[model samples]
Target: HQRLLCEIFNEICIPDLRSNINVDRILTLRRQVDALKIHRETFEKDLNELEDKHIDKKRKFLELNEKFHNEYAD
Candidate 1:
């Protein structure tokens, strides 16, 4: 009876502990994936805003340059 008790305890308790560790690892990985998705969204929004500002600036510079050339050429 004593030998059988020790055998069962070692087999059951050790595997249970290992399964708990695996669960904790899964939770940690999920949190990191959520964080990366949020960061990517923020970065895309910022990139779009910057692109609009660049187009506006370029348009204004061309208008001013054309006006200056016409006035001086006359």
Candidate 2:
């Protein structure tokens, strides 16, 4: 009976414990990492857009200053 129980446990329980429990934990971590990557990408895109807008505004300001200086001869 002891040998039979050992055989049964080796066949069923160990495989279930190793495969199901570990796989669940690994998959959960993978999902969280993927979500974090997406969140980081969104922030990077927003920062790039803000930088582009700032450059555009600065260019316009400089161009207006040049125009006024040329027109008034100052």
Candidate 3:
């Protein structure tokens, strides 16, 4: 009877311990995901700003090129 009780206790407690570990892992993964999301947003914003600057510079360059060609046209 004592051995049977011990077996029953072990069966119940082991699964609870395993579930707790799984929950901890899930929480850690969720925190990592949140951090990655923030980083991705920051990177995307920086990329967009760089792209806008590049477009503006390209437009200015094209305008200058056109003006030079028009002034020197024979």
Candidate 4:
């Protein structure tokens, strides 16, 4: 009985098990790769936008400060 059961399992179950495992691994890896790429792109764009805003704000503040002091001094 044990030998018969082992034969049945080897013949019928092993391929199904291995194929399911391979499909699951491939699908999970693909999803992870896609998600990582998307996240990286978003982070890079966000960083660029923040830096641009910071530079603009600093320039405007400096201009306003110089104008205020020059007018008050005159």
Expressed as tens digits, the lDDT of each residue in 1-74 for candidate 3 is 99998897775644455455567889999999999999999999999999999999999999999999999995
Scanning candidate 4 in windows of ten residues, the lowest lDDT window is: 11-20
Model 4 ranges off by over 4 Å: 1-21
Candidate 4 whole-model C-alpha lDDT, 0 to 1: 0.91
Q: Which stretches of candidate 3 lie over 4 Å from their true place?
A: 1-21
Which lDDT tens digits does candidate 4 get at residues 1-74? 99988897785644465455667889999999999999999999999999999999999999999999999999
- Residue 49 of model 4: what lDDT? 100
| Candidate 2 structure quality by residue, lDDT tens digits, 1-74 | 99988887785644455455667889999999999999999999999999999999999999999999999996
Q: List, in order, the clash count of every candidate structure.
A: 0, 0, 0, 0
By lDDT, the best candidate is 4
Q: Which residue window of length 10 is worst by lDDT in model 3?
A: 11-20
TM-score winner: 3
Over 1-74, each residue of candidate 1 has an lDDT whose tens digit, in order, gives 99988897775644465456666789999999999999999999999999999999999999999999999999
Runs with alpha carbons beyond 4 Å of true place in candidate 1 = 1-21
